[model samples]
Target: MAATAVPTPPLLQISSTQPEPGSLVVEVDGEVDAASAPELSVALEPVWAAVSTRVVLDLSRVTFLGTAGLAELLRAADRADAAGVALRLVGGTRCVDRAIEVAGLAGRLPLSPDLGHAMHR
Candidate 1:
């Protein structure tokens, strides 16, 4: 008997842009889980490295965010704090909001209502 292969879900999509001189915005779509968190990390490491800049994560389009995803956000927040860079999350899907709330990070993570609000601050 041949063993059946487990089907993998769609990978997360990440796009990065420099909205201004000292700001970076990363947009995410699809599901982010243990398998896809590495991609998230790769996209975020540079933002973390660039000290004294603001980084905003746009997650309104995200369908799902798992524990790994939340972990990465926490790490980014820590790095942003240490580097003196502002970090913000714009747009919150139900999954993203629930995950953050469950992780007890509703206040810790800088969350903005929309891109316009995030950009202004």
Candidate 2:
């Protein structure tokens, strides 16, 4: 028998830009799992550190969202609440939506259909 290797998911990529003085838009792409949650957390550090009152996390590009990803998102919501930051999740795919819905966090996390909706809300 020959040995085989399993395929691994791509690493998560997080990027952020401040379009205005008090607002930030963060775009997340690729898979989010236990291996990538830390990257997400590190990327969010600026969100908490900055004076931005509003933050929009764009997840439409996310290909996968695992339990660890969900947990990180919940923690993000808590951190936002405690910090008095208005955090919104925008543009998620079915995979992302299913994970959140299955975890019963759809109601708890602020979700918007797009960037415009997120900014308006």
Index of the highest-TM-score prediction: 2
Tens-digit lDDT track of model 1 for 1-121: 9999999766799998887888888999888889888899998887777636788899988888899988888888898888898888975678888888878888998578898798788
Q: Backbone clashes per model, in order?
A: 0, 0
How many residue pairs clash in model 1?
A: 0
Runs with alpha carbons beyond 4 Å of true place in candidate 1: 1-10
TM, every model? 0.86, 0.87
Q: Give the range where candidate 2 is weakest over 10 consecutive residues by summed lDDT.
A: 45-54
State the lDDT at 118 in candidate 2: 90
Candidates' RMSD to native: 3.4, 3.5
lDDT by residue for model 2 (12-67), tens: 88888887788889899998899999899888976876855888889989989999
Which pairs clash in model 2? none
**Maximum-lDDT candidate:** 2
